[model samples]
Target: MKIFVARLQGTPVFDPAGDQIGRIRDVVVGLRLGHRPNVHGFVVEVQPRRRVFLPITRVRRIEAGAVIFTGRINMRRFEQRTTETLAIGEILDLTVRFDDQPMTVYDVAMEETRPSTWEITSVALYKGRRREPRIVDWGEVSGFDTLQKDQGAAGLIAAFESLRAADMASALHDLPSKRRIEIARALNDTRLADVLEELPPDDQIGILGTLEPERAADVLEEMGPDDAADLLHDLPEEQASELLALMEPGEAAPVRRLLTYPEDSAGGVMTSEPVILPPSATVAEALAHIRQQDLTPSVAAQVYVSRPPTETPTGTYLGVSHFQRLLREPPSTQLGTVLDPSIDPIRPQFTLLQVAYYLANYNLVAAPVVDELGRLVGAVTVDDVLDHMLPEDWRERADYRDE
Candidate 1:
């Protein structure tokens, strides 16, 4: 059997009991002085974001999207030796001389020569980014001197191109700190913002610290106001203030407002941005608004009906129009007609516990916050509440996948 190392990334690895242990993160290959590199094992990311080595001898089958294996995993974290190379992470993007032409390494194909033993047999090289890669004997390519030079993060990012923001963040977190910063620097502001929202506060601050203050502010602006506020809350007051000051006035306004309330208060946890619209907006308009690519699932599940002003601190709060209602009503039906205003809005001063009980009582995925004038200020999602309720390092904790 032949498996392309790049494709093995993120593949689920199952144990003898058919329970998934973890996902494949990278392939560990030991380079010899000459001949093809020996495939040692896989870097399997287990619980708690730990990457452990899985010897090829333990692997029983390599099928679509899954790697079935026998025996109990050691669970000890894997550390790369200087003599070892990561197939997907290190070798995939290396430039090599194949025949007389210089080509970019795109993938390394591992062939099972006999029994459970595997070896790197060939590599897929791209003449150019737009061209399809051609497979050539692994020995044909030169420059595997194993010299560890700083590689462009483009190759690393490309390997994670298919992942969602959360998945991408996990993949990145597994990388070395320097590499993580390198990749973060390569990502554009908007993309970086999305991934940062999924990462823990510490990781967010670490990567943000690497960027210039101006770029850091731009990334913050791209993030959800609530998320940006939460991240800033983690930084030193002076540093946070500097980044906020660098942000555009209009973009910084909402985040600044969010930061004023106590971290555990309703206003602090609520996102200043939600699918908000005037009462006159039609059901179809609400649906279209929620359909935006950037809207999170919880936020998109409902729309806020308000008076004239649509932005946060909107005109007198009307009620919430759940997406289900939008779907059931006529496209031209006004949101105000079917809006659910029976449930009272939470005040900015409400405690996290109070907000949680309110949502639970109303069976709400999200609840709106109102000020003294009854103006809709923001909406607090269940996710936001849970985030604050969980241990600060919950993201750094073990994955529940093993359970």
Candidate 2:
């Protein structure tokens, strides 16, 4: 019997013994080249706030208010895989072309096609506001591969609203490239920039390539200079230069300087916008600056004391004042008075291992990058060093999916 996926959502799921285990969040369906999508499983929100994949094969039966399953269930967190779409999260409310006519999807239903195989069987579409949704066989509409281009990404973005940028990037990686591009287009510049930083180079370039040059430049501006440079480094020299030219002069300057260094060097991996302050600035003022919402924990770990110019490429590097030290000192005290002069800064040309060693040796989360003229150029965080040292595919590691 076909059941509307919308109704299954939030319904409690049970084990063969009738013990409540979780509530259904959505159904995972695998898109086929030219056929109805195969029902892969259900996304179940288990006790204590974990969501895991429950294969359809394990489900004993589906009822109006409950779903029962047999056998053991793995409790590993569910990570969306390639071609697996979330029916409730991604399909419902999507505006797609049905028979060359644009319509909003209201519901989708699935049924067991064989002893253990289930597939989405039909779709409910809105033909008119007052009329009951038009139910049509799923096969009548072209495969989602064809419909993906016409669908808006609002529903998909909503599904990812609660996910961190890294988790969201993982979900985006699992989508078909076309849909991924579509969703990327719909995200605001800052959100897209954060997600882009978490994505691999190939995916970053692909998404960046699809945006209009001006918007792409704006998105790049929102990304960390190191990340922006890294993305541009992978692009053709001409295209990279064009995008740089389109970015605001101040934003482009740091990235341009970063692009000149080898990708693995300390300068290349460092952020030019670390917390910097004049020697005369007070502890109270330094505390307020680091409190900015956008400051990453690594960047906020310490505030560097400098002379005259406080921005990157400042006059003279004084010393560092860690957040802990700031909290312990009197608020009115000058930053220079409390600075830890013993902490050494790394040079721009330090190798990745050298940079890692410097941070490790000092037991510091971030270290300033000093230039030949004794100017503070940038700062490299431990996370930045790890990002360079880890295997290229570290983000895609499958250990999280081990069941």
Candidate 3:
């Protein structure tokens, strides 16, 4: 794997049968799985339409000559088991060098390169303002090289642009509070959400404090209710109230509800965004409503087909459908068929301690909120609880410069 890692992508891959299987497009590893877990397989992109997986077990050898594989599997089976199909556009992004000269891999034809050796088939270059393609011989290249040429040369304009782009993508997840604040100040609301999603509570607070009340409210509205509540709880009471006042009622109301409970509890960290539909709507109507209103309601595996509200004096209390189950069954199939009656909702009164237990025990990313009468109201996301557990200013205070 390290040898291949040293070799740039678009390196040739071969089968034990001496068949020119494909070119190495991507090395798929089980990322989130346990540390040092098995290398799942390699994706060999034969052509635009013929990319396939060469599982780790199939490799007879992986030396300079051929990345010999056992046998071929059907494309459909490969797609079913793999995370994503390798696309030519992705491979085009690769930049490799042959004989120590610069070459781009974009214009390379799939069939041109020898399937058993490291080579370059094509290169993309900007001839003045227009881009030009140059095809080269793979066998002519001495060896493959990695793309790390622009580390120094401090004052170059091109170098600065390259560094700026790299820094944004490789930002430290555990940034200091002050740094977090600076990052928050610089990022727009949407990007802030991406940053905030990964930050701990202390960093979240520090970042939020740097913004004006209106801007802070905007950021909070973008955050889930539970996260917003947790942040609000950390702020000065007056500041918290001011920000709440600045937020929309729909957004503010849920955050306020979450604050009433302890941070660790389900009640404290649940989102109220899951739109509950009444049972009366048809599958087509429900689908239409979801399309029209952008409501992410609970649907059994397909699209959520929920029952309408009951005719009782209080209101209807329909069950949720986990969209996965919804798709497998027929469209006209009744909501009851897909809806799980056993979705034990967490009460708002439950403490954070109890909520954490529920999260740890359950496999759900989020759970539904309901009243004693079984009327659904909100949801509790795992991210909300995680935010609550993290330190509020750890990111900011980490900057102790060894005085």
Candidate 4:
């Protein structure tokens, strides 16, 4: 048998003798990974402002808005366990993204997987006045558990681990300020950096403001230089300076350089941590270097081959070796031998449009940025260029592409 969780709420539970026990207030279910959660029990309101737990095993049948029980119910107050989530209090009526559209959950439909074990199977979404509510499988929805208070910050963060940073940020944006802050506080530095980079300026400021100064600096360091710089630019100069002072000099330098350029310029949006290799580096060495560092696919697409002194960007810009070329060439082949020098790098002051055209014309996912002396300083990625080219509120739109 199947029933909507919303319908179950407020239904009267009767004992074997047909005496009314109480009205159902909420249903509790234990969360499980890779499987539908089974209902544990129900919170039944026995009197005004009083609720008690009635185990599912005690219930004989549910019919016509009333639960018939086979045994006497425990009169003790309902106490939620760490693993339990309230179906009505936590999940029902929450906004979830479904079928590429935002939908409000009107009710959750549960199926009895076993004789006494019921698990949530689908959600009924509110459509319109004349239309019947749309039923969607539970797996088809995103953001369903994002704002579940029972999950706490750690559980909620784990539930969102599979989501892209942008998707997570979008979901978090809809939560109340208090919940958002609590979740933010629970995220590790690297994870927080990724989410912060995806959020809007106001949200970035709000979350960062909640963190301690040193902690905020640590998160900034973990982010790409361009993203960190952008966030710092939006903050008050004094506050930005304080945070910068807390960061390691090496990590802070690139952001400082990026801050010197106009926000929409190539240098401004370019990440300072490109895979730069000395001209002497062999294909094998380059591959090893890339493997050692955690890089996004776009950033790892190529490695810049520059002149000597690899540590602090002191070399003249030579060219780049695409990852495909590296794989095709022998391991002993020097990067300088197969460098693609035809692609001219973008200048610090180039406008966003110029950067876009340059990347498009070169058919490159990323293009290096150079100073007046023609030294490699950073690389502007296609994603960053498009981010600046798109409308300011594009992130808030339901159909916005997060890639």
| Best by the lDDT measure | 1
RMSD after Cα superposition, model 4 = 17.0
Q: Report the Cα lDDT for residue 287, model 1.
A: 88
List residue ranges in candidate 1 displaced over 4 A: 12-23, 43-54, 63-84, 95-104, 125-135, 140-149, 399-403
The residue-by-residue lDDT of candidate 2 on 306-388, one tens digit each, is 89788778989998999999999999999989989788888999999999888888898999999999999999999889988
Comparing 3 with 4 on lDDT, the higher-scoring candidate is 4
| Tens-digit per-residue lDDT, 108-131, candidate 1 | 899898888899999888877654
lDDT of each: 0.87, 0.85, 0.51, 0.79
Model 4 over residues 24-117: C-alpha lDDT tens digits? 7668887666667788888776642346788887878988879988867776556678788777656654667888887666677788888887
Q: What value of lDDT does candidate 3 attain over all alpha carbons?
A: 0.51
What range of 10 consecutive residues in model 2 has the weakest lDDT sum?
394-403
Model 1 earns a TM-score of 0.87
- Output the lDDT of residue 180, model 1: 80
**Candidate 3 lDDT score at position 258:** 64
lDDT of 3 by residue, 1-403 (tens): 2242324245567665677756654444441222222345566655322445777566556766456677764343134234332222122333456556654443332221223322223233222223454545444432223433321111111211222221221232322233334435666685565556555555567667778878988988887675577678878999999999999997787778668766666666666555455555545544444454322232212222233443211143556666555556566766655667766667777766666788678666566666676655566656556556655543333232221
Candidate order (lDDT):
1, 2, 4, 3
TM-score of each model, in listed order = 0.87, 0.76, 0.49, 0.64
What's the distance in Å from true for residue 318, model 3? 2.2
Candidate 2 regions off by >4 Å?
1-26, 30-39, 43-53, 56-85, 88-93, 96-102, 106-148, 397-403
Model 1 residue 2 CA deviation (Å) reads: 4.0
